[model samples]
Structure formats: C-alpha cells, structure tokens
Target: MRLEDLLPSPEPVRFVAADGTETPAPAGHVRPSDELLVEAHRRMVLGRRFDTQATALTKQGRLAVYPSSRGQEACQIAAVLALRDDDWLFPTYRDSVALVARGLDPAEVLTLLRGDWHCGYDPAAVKVAPQCTPLATQTIHAVGLAEALRRKGEDGVVLALIGDGGTSEGDFHEALNFAAVRRAPVVFFIQNNGYAISVPLAQQTAAPALAYKGVGYGVVSEQVDGNDLLAVLSVLTTAVQHARSGRGPYLVEAHTYRMEAHTNADDATRYRDEAEVTRWAAADPLARLQTYLRHRGLIDDEAVRTAEDEAEAFAAEVRTKLNADVVADPRTLFDHVFAEPTAQLVEQRAQLVAELDAGEA
Candidate 1:
C-alpha cells in the first residue's frame, strides 16, 4: 500500500458512540463479531475492576507504586485480545491490566512495581516482557524479538505497547526505523492518553497524531477511538494481521485519556482540572462497551454478575499474596548476573556468603 494509503484516517475509527449507541461505519472499518464483543466485555469488566483494586492497593501501602490504566481499559484489553496466544506482548508499566488480561498472575504482574524482584514471572514461558517503566524502550526490544522470530521462520508477531509520551523517546523512533527497514513483523500500539505525566500533547509535538509518525518511517499506520473497545479491537486486529502477513510494521495510535494521576504519588489536580476529568469520564470505555453489549442483548445481569465475581476473586488473591510476607534468596542477585560468573563476581559472592555465615555463628 502507498504510504498515504496506510496513513490513519483523519478521524479515529469508531463503531460505538459515547452515548451507548452504534455509529455509522467508515469504509474498510468493520464491526467486530458479537462473540468477540461479548468476550471483550467480560474481560473489560474484569480489567476495570482489577485496575481499581490495584489503585486501592497502592493507597493501602501494599505496593510501592501503581500506574492505573483506568480510562484506558479499552486500549489495555483490546491490545491483548487482538493478539493470538503465540504472539508476544511488550507492555509498559501502566499495562498491568493488560498483563492481567493476558492471564498473568496479578501479584506477579506488579512485582517490579512492588520493588520485590526483577521479574516475577518468566517472560519466555508466557511470551510477555516485563511491564516496562522506561518509556519506549520496550518498542526496541519488541523489534529485536520480531526480527529474531522472522529469522527463525517462526509464525509470531510482537505487539509493543506504549503511551503518547513514549513517542517522544529516541528509542521509540529508532525501533520504528529499524522495524520499517527490516520489515519486522511487529505492531506498535500507542495509547495516546493526552499526557506525558504532567506535559500535555500540545507541548509534546505538533504532529497531527502519533500514528502519522509511522508513515514517515514507512510503516502502515492507523488511529482508532481508544475509548471505544470495538474500535480499538477492530483497528488493532487489522494492524496485527498486516504485520503478520509480512507487511513490515504497523503503528496504531489510540486516542484515549488517563483518568487517574500518573502514579499513586502524582497530584493530577496540579495540572488538569475536574472539568477535564469529568469530560473524559463521560466517554468511559467500560460504560460504552457495556451499553453496546446490553443493547445488542449480548450480556445480561447474570453475565455481569459472573464477571464481577471473577474480578472480585482475582482482586482478593492479589491482596492476599501481596499482603503476606515474602522470602527471597539473596543469592539470586548473583545467580543471573552472568552465564559464566566472573572471578570478581565469584569472589564477591563468597565474601557475602562468608559474612552471612559469620553472622549466624
């Protein structure tokens, strides 16, 4: 496709309106199946509740910090639901919800944020990178993995998730250029939630949208209504396929909002007012999706209850595990530092063990 043809639509694609009604579809945009929508609704309900519980945990001091993906649940869940089990997921720190949706243990997902361990779960086992906190760095890692998969003739693609703020990072650009040139089977999913912590999009870049950046890098790109789950899933499903089909890389910019402060430590009131928050909340992803599902007779009270029950159970387990004391071996710090221990490292490890032995004696 021509670069211009690959450029995202001037307006974001949407299938569900903010008011719980269906909207007219644009050319090339198709409604996701009812089966998919129903499944998404269930997971989204679980995801939103999980997000709330995580935020509560931070307040209760169980976690060192938490970046809640409250309003961005649509983006968070769709990014995962769009992918196959074999596909790899690269998530940002704010993507614990996505990690959970991908069937990761919630407590394990928060391990890095809790300052307990480097990675609580095995990335290779699940094909999920640790939830990244260093901005667009995951994008580069995803590209490298995608290239490796290509070289190995594996039928896999990588979905590298980032935020609008991450687009400004040099790593994000480098990854895009490399992926485009190498035709790496990777998709860069950017949830443009209107802020890079305190800085607004206006101060960040003059580009029409983040997806446009991909076009310049020779990657197919599109923008979707991030607040609309159907729209996000539709756009992302197509993007993933495009890359899987050897079309190089695809970038999707989802226009969404951050309903909470950057982290538990941030005071959002300092930068944005209540009116702005209220305005965005009016377009809440969960509410809109639920509305559409109910209107279509896809979900009823029983299904709602089922999702709530599951979410509560999920939250309870996370609370129980995280609140309990953890026992970790100090030797693990030395174990993975190198495949073959350097002489200095071995000596340091011996010294540490000796010190522990002396204390016991």
Candidate 2:
C-alpha cells in the first residue's frame, strides 16, 4: 500500500456528546461490561480525590507543587481500562491519574512531589514507566521499549501518553517515524488539553488535528472527545486491538480541556479567558457521566453520596499516610543513578553524607 493509504486521516470518532447523550460505537466495537463501567467510575472518583488532596497539601506547604488532573480523569481512566494488565504504559508528569488507574498507589506517587525518589516501585513491575518530566522524551523511550518487545516476540502493546504541545517536538515525530518504520506495537495517546502550560494548541500546530501528524509517518490515527469516557474507551480499545494484531502504531488525539492551572506554580488565568473555563465546565466529564448514569437508572442520589463518601475516605487515608511517613533519606538519591556506582558518584555520595552530618541543606 502507498504511504498515504497507511496513514490515518484527520476525521474524529465520537460515542458521546457534551450533554450526557450516548452514541453507538462502530459496528465491530464491543461495549464494556457493567462491572467495568462501575470500576471506571470508581477509578475516576479516586483520581479526582487524589488530585484534590495533592492540591490542598501543596497549598499547605506539605508538598513542593502539584499538577491537578481536575478535568482529565475520564481521559486517563478510559485509556487505562482499554489496556491489559501486561501492556506497558508511558506517562507524562501530569498523568499520575493514568498511573493511578494502572494500579499505582496514591501515597507512593505523592512521594515524588515530596522531593523524594522518582517513585516507590519498579516501572517494569507494573508495566508503567516512571512519569517523565522532560515533555515528549518518553515517546522515544516507549517506542524503543515496544520495538524491543516486538523483537522478543512478546504479545503486548505500549501506550505512550503525551500532551498536545509534545506533538510539536522532534521526539514525537522521531518516535512515530521509528514506530511506523519498524511496525512496533505501540499507541501514541496525545492528550490535547487545549494548552501546553499556557500555550494553546493552535500555537503549537497549524495542522487541523494533532492526530493528523501521524499521517506524516504512516501511523494510523484517530481523534475523540477525551472527556467522554465511553468515547475515549472506544478509541483506545481500537488502538490496542490494532497494536496487538500487529498493525503497528496508532495515534489517538484525545480532545480534553484543562480546567485547572497547568501546575501549582502556573496561573492559567493569565493566558486563558474566564469564559472559556465556564464553557468547558459545562462539559465536565464527571458531571456528564453522572447525568447519563442517573438517566439510565444505574445511579441514584444514594449511590452518588456513597461514592463521594468513599472517595473522601480514600483521600483522607492517603493524606494521612503521606504526611505520617518519615522523610526518605537523601543518600538514597545516589543509589538508583547507576546499577554500579561510578567512582565519581561514590565520591558525590560521600560528599552528600558529609554535608548531611554537618547539618547543611
């Protein structure tokens, strides 16, 4: 087939509306089970609760800074639900919600914000990479890992999550090109939250959609309403199927809105208008999903109240643990840098210990 034929077009697929309406999935697509739907809702609630706690802790000076995933829980939960436990996940710094959905603990995640080690577990243990801060770099790492897995005859996919601003980066392009050329088993999940730390998506690209960029590298792609969990789940399921079936990489542009500032250190109001925030708030995923579920008689006031209570309890527990735990040793920072510490690193560790003994910062 021609390269153009192999590339994904810019058309979008949507299975839900902003007003809590449902649309049918494609004929071949399968609907998720009720159990999965309930689980998805639980995960989203937990993620939002965790985000709220983290933000409060940041404001109270318990954490360095926090990036809220306020309006993006559905995006992460849906994408994560579409994956198998064995599939790998590469997440960006702002995607701890996605990591949480993939079974990462909230207290362990808060450790990173506490200025401790990268995270509490081996990334390979849960098949989720450590959250990458240098935007878009994880794309390259994900592609390489997928390529290695493919060579080893493994039957799993790698879902690489990135921001829209990352789409403009060379690493994004390089990863897509490499994945396409090698037919690596991976999915490029672009969370286009309309802004990259105050830079709107329009400023980052002139393309009609970020997913269209995949066309340049012959990767199949699709765009969907990231706020609609059902829609995101459908698209991600398709992408996973494609990768598992040896169709190589797929690019998924999840159209979401960032309801909060980029991070605790950011002031989004300086760049975005209040009217825009108001508009997006009307389409809030959690509210819309609640409306839909209630309409379907699958949820009630008591159920919602119960969910709220459960979420609050979970958040409180995490906060208690995070605050009560003893601070990690500063010396352990040098331990994970290398499998075998270099002479220079050994010297650096000694210097750090000496400084600690001297009661210096």
Candidate 3:
C-alpha cells in the first residue's frame, strides 16, 4: 500500500469517548488481558494527576517550569508498556508520564525541570535516558544505544519518543538512517500533536506521512490512532516485538492532539482557538477509559473517588518533597565536569568562587 494512504485523516482509531464508547480492535491484534487494561487505566490517571499537580506547582512558584502532556496520555502509556525491562527508553521533555510509568520517581523526575541535575535516578539504572529537550538529539542517542546492544548480541531494544516537530530536525533523519544501516533494535515513536509548539505539521514537512519517512531508509513503519489507547497499545506491542525479534527498527506515528499550552511559558491561546480546546477536552483519554472501565464493571463511583483522593495526596506529597529537599550548591556543577579537573577548569572554578566572595552580581 502507498504510505500516503496511512497518514492521519478526520477519522482514525478511536476507543473510549468522553461520553463513553468503545471501538473494536484492528485485525490481527488480539484484545488485551483485563489486567493490562486496568493497569493502563491506572497509569493514565496517575500521569494526568502528576502533570496537573506539577503545572500547578510551577504556577504557584513551587516548581521552576513545566511542559504539560495533557491530551497525550494514550500515546505515552501505550509505548512505555510495550517495552521489556531490559529495553532502553529515550524520552523527550513531554514524556514525563512515560518516564514515570517506566518507573521513574516523580520527585526525582522533577529535579530536572527544577534546574537541577539530569534526573536523580541513573539512566542506566532504569534503562531510561534523561529527558532530552534539544529536539531530536536524543534520537541519535537512541540509535547508538540500540546499535551497541545489538552488536553485543544483547536481547533488548530502544524505544525513542519524539514529537512531530522533531521530524524537521536533521538529527531525526540522521538517526533513522544510521539505525537503518545498522539494523538497530529500536522503535521511533512519534506523537503527532499537530503543533511543534506553534508550528503545525503542514509547515514542518511535506512528506505524505511521518511514518513514510521510514521508507527512505528501509525502516518498517505503521500509523495508529494516538488518542485510541487500545490501538496505540496493540500497534506498539507489535512494533516492539518486531524490533526485539531482529526485524530492524520500526516507526510508529501516533496521530494525537495537544490540548493544552505547549508549556507553562506558552500561550497556546495565541495560536489556537477555544473551540478547539473544548473539542479536544471532550475527547480526553481518561474520560473514555473511565467510561470503559465503568461499563465493564471494573470501576465505580466509589473507586473513582478513591483514585482521585490517592492522586491528590500523591501530588501534595510531591510538592512538599520538592520544597523540602536541600537545593544542590551551585559549586557542585564543576564536580562532574571531568574525571580529573583540568588546570583551566580549576582556575575557572576559583574565579567563580572569588566572584561569589566579592558579591559581584
């Protein structure tokens, strides 16, 4: 089939609706186990709560700044769940939910956004690299990591997440090309949220579909409804299996929407309209999942209240810990600069200390 035929259109895979409706799974993809569905629901709820509380903290001066993933929960959770423990994760700034679901602690994850170190947890410890904010640079790292693991005869893959905006960067193509040549065990997960900040996909690329970009480099590819949790999960599961089983890298373009401001610093209201926000809100991921759960008798009003209470407490605790933790000294930045400090680095450090002592603003 021609790649253009798979690009997103008005009608894509949709499961739960804000008002509660179910969509059937695509052919060749079996219905997931009940346990997996429940877990997906829990993770999405937690992720949404975490993002909302973090944003609130940033607004109240408790946190530095926040980049929200309001309407992209299905895309995030589906991909993360598809990975094995040994597999690696390459995340972007908006992938906090995925990171947490992959087991990153919320308190530790916040340290990065708070202008501290990368993340308190070691990337190697959890197989998740620090959130890369420099566009598609992490795509290169993902390719490299996957290639290394493959060369060593390791049985694992790398799952790299990027926004549609990232496709415009040279690094994205370069990484894809390198992964293709090496047959790296990796999957490039692209969440097409319409806008790369304010730049829409139409302005970013003329390619028939982002997934088609894989065709140029012999990468296997697929397109899934980013808003449909079931579709996202099924597609990612197959993609991961393909990579792990040595079929080469896979590209999954999830067509989704970004319902909130790009970041706390952004004014989405400037580029988009209120009607759009209302429309997307009505198609929220959590609402549909809850509706499904309720319909299946898996959750009820009491369970909903209990989940909200737990999420609220968790958010409150995260704020308290963030405020209470000892802020790292500014001088410690120099400690990790080298194995042994260079003479020039030593001199620079002394100069900085002297300036601090002199109270030179």
Candidate 4:
C-alpha cells in the first residue's frame, strides 16, 4: 500500500473540553467510568506532587538535575495506568512521573537523577527500561523488545515514551519504520510540549502534526489532548489494545505544555513569554480533571482533601529518602557492561582502585 493510502487525517481525539465539560468521543469510543476517572485523578495528583518535590530537590542539590513534568501529569499518569503490569514501558528522563505511577519506588526512580548510577532499578523486575538519557535511543530498544516478544509468543506490548525534542533524532525515524514493517507491538508516544528545550515546535518541523510521522511509516497514528486525563487514558487504552491484538505499531502525539522550564538547568523565560505560560497554566491538567470530577459529583471536598493529604505524605517520603546521604561503591563502575571485562576496562579499574587506596593512605 502507498504511504498516502495509509495516512489518516491529523485531527486530535478529545473527550473533555478544557472547561471540564464532557465532549463526545469519536464513534466506537465510550467514556470511561466514574470509578476509573477517580483513580486516574488520584494518580495525577500524586504525580504532580512528585514532580514538585523532585524539582525542589534539584534546587537544594539533593538531585543532580531534574526535568519536571509540572503541567503534563495527566499524560504521565494515564499512560502507565492504561497498561497491564506485564507490559513494558520505556521512559525518558522526564517520565519519572509515569514511572512512579507505574509502581516504582520514588527513591529508586530518582537514583539516576541523584547521580549515583546509570539505572536506579532493574528493568526486568518492573518491566520498565532504564529511564533513557540519550535522545530517542529507547525507541529502538522498545521496538526490538516488542519484536522479540512476538517471536517468543509472549503476550505483551511496549510503550515507548519520547519528548518533542527526541522526535528529531534519527533513531526515532528508524525505530518507527522498523516497527511498522515488522508489525511490532509497540506504541511510540510523543509528548509534544511545544518546545524542544528552548526551540519552539514551529522550529522543530513543518509537518502538520507529529502524529503524521507515523502515517508516513504506515503505522496507525492518533493525536489527543494531553491535558485531558480522560482523553489521554481512552486514546492510550485503545492503542494498547490494538498492539496487544497483533496489529501494527501505533503513534500518539499528546498536545500538552511544559509549565516548568525544560529542566531545572533551563531558563524558559529566555524563549517563551510569560503570557504564553500563563495561558497554559489556566489549562492545568490536575485542576481540569478535579473540576470535571467535582462537576460529576464523583469527587467531593472531603475526597479532594484526602487526595491532597496522600500527596503530601508521598512528598514527605520522597524528601526524607532523598535527603539521606548515598555511598558510592566504586567497584560498580566496572560491573554489568560485559560478561568478561575488557583489558582496557580492567586497567582503568585498577588505576582507579590504586588512586583511591593512595588517597586513603
């Protein structure tokens, strides 16, 4: 089939307006239950609190660096909640919110950000890849893992997360092409938060939408309101179901905004106007979902207070754990890279050990 024939219109799928009013989903799509919506809201609130704490830690030098997903909680929470426990998630540095929501310990998730190790937790234990630092490299890993699952007759799918900046990487294109051709059970989720670091989306690409890139590879693609928790959950649920059913890979572009700077290291004001940030602040994901639930009588003042209390408790736990000093084992540097250490690596390890011994002496 020609690429044009497989391409769908770039219209976004949304089930809730910014004002918290219900909107009609496309045909065959049903609105989620109030129970599920409440659960999703709880996760989003926790994610917001987690992001806030992590950013504060960066400021206090408790964390080396942090990329806060302040306004994008809905996208992070919904993506993980939509998946089964057996499914794998490949996250980027900014996806700590998603990782936390997926049952990873908050301290473990921040281990790498704390500058202790490359990976804080085992990928095999939690079915989550190490939070990738290099741009778009995880996409290829996700595709390869999904293809391997298919070969092994395993019942699983992979959700690969990337940022707007990552979409520009060559690995992004290659991974998408390979997945589409191989019919890999993987979903490439691009969180387009309007800027690639300081560079605006207009500067990123002239394509109608990032999801359109999936169409070029003959992969099914959809766009959704990243701020709307319900909409993001619905869209991701459908995509995951499609992949699990042996359909080709899917691409989802989440239209969201980064409320904070790209990282604690960036000054967003250099590139974006305060007025634009103010506009997105008004559409804050956590507030929108809370408003929707309140309007539906699914959430009351008491429930809101309970959620807040829970978030506070989580933040406290993260703070206490992160404030503790971490001891580094120098030997770990030589571990896990290869079954047998290379001669050069052995030499480097010995030199480091001798230097440490001399200093101690």
Candidate 5:
C-alpha cells in the first residue's frame, strides 16, 4: 500500500467550534448525555480553579514547582473521565488535574509537586502510575502494563498521557511500536500544547501532526481540538472504547496551547508573543464550555455559582492541607525500595539517624 493510504486523515475530529457553537459529531459518534456534560463542565471548572490555586501555591513556596494545566483542563479531565475504574492511567508531571478527576485526593496528587520523597498516593490502590518526571518514560511502562494485562486475559486498558515534547523521545516511538505489535489495549493521548518548555512545535518535529507518528506504527490515530470539552470527551471516549473492546492501541493528539509558562521557574514572554497568547486565551476551554452549556440551557447563573462555590471549597481544602506542616521522616527514604533493606542501605540509614541525633545534641 502507498504511504498515503496508510495515513490517518489530516483533519482533526471536532464536535464544538472555537466560539462554543455545536458542530455535528462525526457519524457514529455517541453524543454525551446531559448529565455527563454537566459533570464534565463541573470538572473543568474545578480543574481550572485547582490549577489557579496550585500556581498561587508555587508563588508562595507551598509547592516546589507547578506546571499549570490552565488552558488544558478539558483534555486532562476528559481523558480521565473516559476511563473505567479498573483502567490504568500513566500520567506526566503536568497531569495532577487528571489524577484528581480520576477521584484521587487533590492534596495527595500534589505530593510530588510538594517536594515529597515519593508519590503522595498509592499507585496500586488508585490504578494510576506515579506522575512520571522523565519525559516519555511512562509510555514504555504503560505499554508493558497493558501488554501484561492482555497476556493474563484481563480486561484492562491503559491511558498514557504525554506532551508535544515527549513525542520526540525515543521511548515514545518504542512504546508505540510495542503496543502495535502486541495489540496492547492502550491509548496514547498526546496533549500537543505547542511547546516543550521554550521550544516551539515547529522546532520539535516536521511531522504533519503528532498523530501521524502513530500511523507509521499501524496504530489508529486521530486528532481533536483539545480546548473544546465536548470534542475532547467524544474523541477520548471513542478511543477508550476501542481499546477496551480488544482492539489494538489508539493515538489521539489533542491540539491545544499552554497559556502559562512551562512551569513556575520559566518565563513564557521570552519565547512567545503576547498576541499569540491572547488568540489562544479567546479559545479558552473553560470559557467555551461555559458558553455552550449556558446556550443549551444545561446550565444557568445558579449552576455557575454553585460550580464556582464548589471549586473554591476544593481550592481552600488543598490550600489548608498544603500549608499545614508535614513532618518528614528521614527513614522513609529507605522504605519501599526493596523487600528487605540491603546492608548498605541499613548502614546508610543508621548513619543518617546518628547525624540527626548528633545535630540535636
């Protein structure tokens, strides 16, 4: 077959316009119910608020650093909501909102960002892998876990989240190749937020779209307007269903922009123009989704206020917990590393305890 015949179409699948108008979903797309739509809206609102609060915490030194998902809430929330309880989520550091949406505690989800030793929550209990810091590494773990489930005859799917920058990682290619060859039940959701820190997409890859990379691996690939909540939800839900039904892996490249700097430590002004940021801000996922919900009479001023109130409560709770003193036990460093501590680890732990005791004396 010709290369053209093997590629996914260039057009992204979208069900909502930038102006918040309803567009027809592609044929066979199942429209979400009013309840699901409302719930999604609530989560989006809460996600944005959570991001705002977390960013503030970074400024106040409550958090070591934060990669704000300010403009990417729709993609994060929709990805998690599309998964089943038994499904696994492998997230990057920027995916705290996704974890929270998956029913993990917000404060616990931020534990890593809070400069804690280990991931705050138990991954096994929540079916979420630790928020991976090394780019694209989690993709390999995700494919391996999915393949293991398939081998064991377990009905579980894995959703692996990566950024535009991660697409350039070698692990990303390896994971896609393995998933395609093994027919692993996994979905690779790439949030193309236009930058990997100061580097822009044009400099990242010359591929027509990141989804095209998946096509080369013989994986079903598609793109969506990541800022549109309904569009993201629809596309991700379809991909999740496909994976769960014993179909091979799918790749979704969500076209979105990061409205904030890469993290608390970087200056976005150095890399991007203010007008460009303004253009994306106009297409803000939260604003567009609110407009759609209000236009359809699915939400009202009262509902908006209620959502805002709930978001504030969530922010307040996170703030209170984060501000409280957390006593760190130095011994915890040796825990969970091995079934039994090595002799070297035992000696190191004893030396650390002795140093602490000496300092106290």
Candidate 6:
C-alpha cells in the first residue's frame, strides 16, 4: 500500500447518528448485517448489566475493585464480537465487560480483581489474556503473541484493547512500531473513554486523534464513533480483515465516554461536572441502538423484552456465584506460572505443602 493509505481520517467513521438515524458510511466501510447488529445489541445490553452487577458487588464488599464500562458498552461489545472465536483478545482491567461479552464466565473474569488467585480462566482455552491493570502493557504482549502466531503460520488475529490514556505509554508506542515493522496480525483497539482515572483526554495527549499515532509506525488506522454500535462494529470488522490478510497491523481509536467514575474508589464529581455526564448520557449506546432497531422493525417489543430478561438473568447468575463460598487450593499459586515448573518453584511448592500439613496437624 501507499503511505497516504496508512493515515486515518480526521473525522470518525460513523454509520448511525447520535439520534438513531442511519447515516451513509464511506464506500469500503461495510455496515454489519442486521442479524449481527441485533446480536450485538443483545450482548451490549448483557454487557452493561454485567458491568452494573460487578460494580454493585464491589460496593457490597463481594469484589475488590471494578472499573465500570457503563457508558462504553458499544466499544466493549463490538470489539469482542467483531473477531472470530479463534482470534485472540488482549483486554485491560476495565474490559471485564468485553470479557463477559466474549462469553467468559463472569466469576472467572473477575477472579483477578477479586484477589482470589491468578487468572481465573485459562488464557489458552479462551484466547483472552488475563485482564491487565498496567496501562498499555497488554499491547506489547498482544504484539508478541501475534508475531508468534504469524511465525507458526496460524490464521488467528490479535486485538489489544486499551483506554485513551494508555496510548501515552512507551509500551504502546513500542508495540505499534514493532508490529508495523514485522507486519504482525494485531489490531490495537483504543477506547477513548475521555479519561485515565481523573485525567481527561485534553490533559492526556495533544494529538489530533489517537488513531493518528499509528501513522508514524506505518500502521493503518481508523477512528470510529464508539457510542454507535453499527459504526464500531463496521470499523473493527474491516480492521480485523486487513490484519488477517497479512497486510500488517491496524490501529483503531473509538471515541466514547465513561459515565461512571474511573472506579468505585474514584470521586468523579471532583473532576467532571454533571452537565458533561448528562450530555453523553443523551447519546447512550444502548438507547441509540434500541431506537434504531425498533425504527427498522428489526426487533419487536417481544425481542426487546427477551433481551432485558436475559440480561437480568445473567446478572443474577453472576451474583449468586459470587455470593457463594469459594473453595480455593493454595497449591494453585505455583501452577500456571510456567509450562514447566522451575527448580525454585518446585522447592517453593514443597515448602508450602509441608507448612499446610503442619498447620493441619
């Protein structure tokens, strides 16, 4: 391709207006099918409910911390739904919503945050990396994994999910550079939720758009209206196809918002005014998509009701599981750390086993 083709447009790729009207998209950017959109809508609904349940659990002392993705449902769900099951997902700590949308058990998705043990689910089994906490670090891991997959002649594409603030990290830059140079099959999906903790986007980076950051690395990039599910799904579908075809890595920056504070521990009122929150709420992803589908007659009242019921049921199941007593084996600490246990780990496991035996005696 050409150098000019690597640059992202200043305006975000959009298909649905904020008011639920269908808009025209650029020629090559195909709108996702109706069936996919409806399924995406249901998952988006379920994802938001899951996020709410997790936050409530945090407040009830059932969880340690929850970085809610309340307003970013479209980005969270669309990112996972766009990929094939064989494709890999590298998620950030706040991406539990995305993890659940990817069909991971909610309880297992929260294991790390709950402080129960290491990654609750096997990364290899599900194609999802452990939910990473440090900013932009997962991008490097995603790139490395993508390169390994490429070297092994696998068809899997990797998508690394990040927040806007993570773009400032050195790892994020390094990953983009390496992936671009090596033509790795990775897509960097940035959820520009307007803040890194209390820091707003304005304070984070002066770049016209985070998508533009990929240009210097020669990675093709795109910006999308993240609140519009149709737009997000469309852009990501194209990005994944571009990477899977061996063209190189792609970068996507979704312009979205975080309605809730950074986490339950954060005081959002100190940094942002209610007026800004109210404005974004007017463009809520769930409300917008539901309106669009209803207008198109794609989903009827019964369909909407069924989706709500499913979401409620999903939340209830998560709550029940989290409330139940946990049975954990201390020996698991030494497991999953390596494919083959090192001598030191073997020695440490023996010492722990002896201590447990003595305590029981």
Query: What are the lDDT figures for the candidates, one per model?
Result: 0.91, 0.84, 0.83, 0.90, 0.91, 0.92
Ranked candidates, highest lDDT first = 6, 1, 5, 4, 2, 3
lDDT of 2: 0.84
lDDT per residue as tens, model 6, 1-361:
6878988876998888888988877667888899999999899889988988999999899998889999899999999888999999999999998999888999999988888965889899999998899999999999999999999999899999999999989999999999999999999999999988988888988899999999998999999899999989989999999999999999999999999999899999999999999999999999999999999999989998899999999999999999987888899888878989999999999999999999999
By lDDT, the best candidate is 6
As a whole number from 0 to 100, the lDDT of residue 68 in candidate 1 is 86
1 or 3, greater by lDDT: 1
Please give, for residues 169-257, the per-residue lDDT of candidate 1 as tens digits. Answer: 99999999999999999999999999999999999999998889998888889999999999999999999998898888999999999
lDDT (Cα, 0-100) at 90 in candidate 2? 91
Residue 135 displacement (Å), model 1: 1.5
Better of 2 and 3 by TM-score: 2
Ranking by TM-score: 1, 6, 5, 4, 2, 3
- lDDT string for model 5 (159-224, tens) is 999999999999999999999899999999999999999999999899989989998888988888
What's the CA RMSD for each of the models? Answer: 1.1, 2.5, 3.3, 1.9, 1.8, 1.2
Highest TM-score: give the candidate number.
1
- Residues forming the 10-long window of minimal summed lDDT in candidate 3: 5-14
* Model 4 steric clash pairs: none
User: Model 3, 5-24: lDDT tens per residue?
Assistant: 33333244454555667666
| Candidate no. 4 TM-score | 0.95
Residue 125 displacement in candidate 2 (angstroms): 1.2
Comparing 5 and 6 on TM-score, the stronger one: 6
Residue 201 shift from truth in candidate 2, angstroms: 1.4
Query: How does residue 332 of candidate 5 score in lDDT?
Result: 87
Point out the higher-scoring one by lDDT: 2 or 3: 2
